[model samples]
Target: MNKDLADIFGNLVNRIVSFAHLAFDGRIPEGGAPGETELRLAHDLEQRIKALHRHHTALEFRAGAATTRAIWDAANAYQQHTAPWTAIKSDPARAAVITRVGLNLVALCATLGWSIVPNLSERVLGAFGCNNAVPRWPTGPLLPLLNSGAGTPVARLGLPVEKISSEKVAHLTARFGA
Candidate 1:
């Protein structure tokens, strides 16, 4: 689970960083430079995500519901902020980044038994394009740290996690209750 979390968090960070470049560096080419409000919102969202990533890394990639909620809130806020921008909404690349981030976040929340509003998830999934994409959950060896319930304290952010191999790949699936 530690390795899995690491991969998820890492990918999210990569996506946010890439989007930040596009939002702040004016690398959107035809999108033109974003206004101050958009830039400020993007910067704030990026910084929050980065801080979460750093804290998670220090905790060895083991985070709880609070961390997951924090991530969702930040990204969701950014999505809402940029929803009014026709340029951003029309751009496939930029829209894809936000959509992918939201999709993965929903998946992560499900895997960790975290709760998210159903309408919000549906709305986010519909952003830009409705490409029936499914979120890929982590599939790898079960880390002993997660199984043992032992973790190194890292500023009360989360527990420590490390990779440990077992017999086969343990696939964790999230089931929704009816």
Candidate 2:
């Protein structure tokens, strides 16, 4: 079960990262500007992202619930063992619960776009007793990131700047003497 959960979470994170990369670098496939194909692909991507978000949320909730159950079960077992003392410290069980919680937290952080520095720092710093500074989320949609030279994924994938018009092509040729 843990492995399955981890795999699903990992896949979700990968997809989100891919989507973010595509959005930032403007590698969205062209389809005659506002053509039907482009609209359809945009809709499909939106739906896929939403579905991924829901799945990630559900997994996080389930993992948290499971951790709570494990903790409770361990506590009950400890009480039974130390009857009159009313406390039975089960270090092993406690450790297991902590491990499960940690894994779930990591998955949650990775899947919800929280792994990105700007988003992560903005959302999680307060919980970790940090009050130094918060980064702002990107203002526009993710597409601009993919199009900009600064996009990490764009650089990694070696995606070229898309040529959308003859004038732009001519201008580039003139400027760069291609």
Candidate 3:
């Protein structure tokens, strides 16, 4: 409803799109392979995701924007803290773990986001190699991972959005409550 909220959605879409594109694109550095740290991080992230799900469910029942705020905050935090780009080059192995966890995190968010924006969520799911149905929460390490080894290659994944337009920001901010 507001510019800050719009900014959050815009950023979440961008981050998810980037993760999937880079992973299946065969652009990852050779040294990166999913490992122990990844496992730990995945478990922690799963808990966070479940909590988000529960919160979302509760609000819809009691009858809210609560979940949106929580997810956007989580997505932004993960995006900032987990620098998959840097890890891919510096520590490929760690990068693998980092990227996977981050991707899964985004997948979880997208699944939750699907109901609100079916088209966008569908594209997000397809990118993650899913056909239909929201993926079960607390997914495994590789549940939604990009399988570069799968069949023939397709068109390279391009970014849906790079930055929010000033027009969009102004439009969104103006629509917010006075």
Candidate 4:
């Protein structure tokens, strides 16, 4: 919306991207073990991601208020046409208000930047009972999203690929039995 609000959103996005890089690249300080690093990263990422999500929710509330005001302003100008529907299209003043609201929404999205991906990944993992485990990247349709232009920040982080030995895999299967 305003310059101040836009700046705040931009800062939040930058923080999110930085934390995501740490989590996804396995640069997060891990205490020990094979899956240990992944687990810790997932937990740290979840906390930061949730904070960013809360910020986004607050922005949405502000945006909704702006949109409601625009709609009300538009309603006052309704005349020859019907009631509520005509208010949206028939008034020039209302049209300007609507346009401003739309621009604000666009600005908000642009400022948030790369924060959406890892947050989404966390949700997907939760759906599978992974409980904040950082699943391997490129595991599904997410691969394309992570490789697309929209995924530039994600690609830049460069997740590590550890070659699991067959013996270790067998041991894991025997132990965890996944």
Candidate 5:
């Protein structure tokens, strides 16, 4: 069950941050600032996760399981519903938008998924330029770390993730439910 959620988040951070790294030609930004459209998408995602977090925090044993699943589901839905990558060649202006959204999405995941996978989330946050800060629950529209003074932006995103094996699937099927 743990691996099930980790795999979803791992794949999401890897793919999205990979795209964000390439979109800027490997140069992130001075203060890890992503573009406007990216920020908007990230803010929207944060809102969804925060909503789920509010609902699950009251439960004891299943406190974060539902929130983790919600984040996973939301990430998958975003990948399926939007093709931000299509803009690279078709519309140069749109490329920035895609990059911002992708990078910020990674940031959002880090903030919201900290409880589920703290170390992995920290890596994703580091890739986005937040080094020492912890993510606050019920996150607001703006990311404090991204806008603050911190780590240098890179041309290539460095997300450290471990892939989940197929054997983990059998263990997870029994646990996933609403």
Candidate 6:
């Protein structure tokens, strides 16, 4: 696999894992109303998570049939759990369960070679809502590099790169000779 592609996938996996943890921890109690600040935070997190997914898809990485099906199943489960957020707000415990489902989906993605780092889960914690919690996102020229025609895997993808299965890699190799 391209090192640049691998790095991008690893970073995205880290971000997804962190965001999933935050979403899980952001749940309120049953019959409890969330404040404006909480709502804003949730909204920001939601948008960020959506952006992550969009970027991942834009990479167009493909996996084996079973792995792809498993990923889709996990994603579908996460969506099913999170779809009725407003209705389930009255059931806060269920909200936690839903967030946990999201975490499971993220975890599955991370486990299935979507991440280059093998011990990333051990390093990345889901410590959201803590005073010391600070997201350690990449502080580099990722956006500009991706948008530019730099000939890197990310630039070639025309977006960010995500997990590339062996089959996909072979296909891309035959097609692009990269």
- Point to the candidate with the largest lDDT: 5
Give per-residue CA lDDT, model 3, range 72-151, as digits (tens): 57666766776777766776666665555555555566676665655655675676567676655444543335222233
Runs with alpha carbons beyond 4 Å of true place in candidate 5: 28-47, 59-63, 142-159, 164-178
Model 4 CA lDDT for position 118 = 40
lDDT of 3 at 107: 58
Best by TM-score: 5
Residue 102 error for model 4, in Å? 24
Q: Tens digits of per-residue lDDT for model 2 on 116-168?
A: 23343333333223344542223333233212222122112121112247898
lDDT of 4 by residue, 1-178 (tens): 3433333333332333344344324112122122332233334433433444565577765544344333222222211122212333565334232222222222223322223334433432332233434443222222122112321223221221124679997998899987
Per-residue alpha-carbon lDDT of candidate 5 for residues 15-76, written as tens digits (9 for 90 to 100): 75676556655443332234564456557666766666666566543656666667666765
Ordered by lDDT, highest first, the candidates read 5, 3, 6, 1, 2, 4
**How many steric overlaps does candidate 3 have?**
3
- Model 2 scores a TM of 0.23
Ranking by TM-score: 5, 3, 6, 1, 2, 4
In the range 1-178, model 6's lDDT, one tens digit per residue, is 4465345344444433343334443322122333343334344434444455554467634433234334434354434435435435577554444434443333334433323343433232222221222323322332221122211111011112345689998998999997
Residue range 36-69, candidate 1, lDDT tens digits:
5444544554455455555556773434334665
For candidate 4, list the clashing residue pairs, or say none: none
For each candidate in the order shown, give its overall lDDT on alpha carbons.
0.38, 0.33, 0.55, 0.33, 0.59, 0.38
TM-score of each: 0.30, 0.23, 0.60, 0.20, 0.66, 0.31
Q: In candidate 3, which residue ranges exceed 4 Å CA deviation?
A: 1-3, 19-44, 55-64, 133-178
The TM-score, computed over Cα atoms with residue i paired to residue i, of candidate 3 is 0.60
Residue pairs in clash, model 1: none
Provide the lowest-lDDT 10-residue window in model 3: 146-155
- RMSDs, each prediction? 17.4, 25.2, 5.0, 22.9, 5.6, 16.5
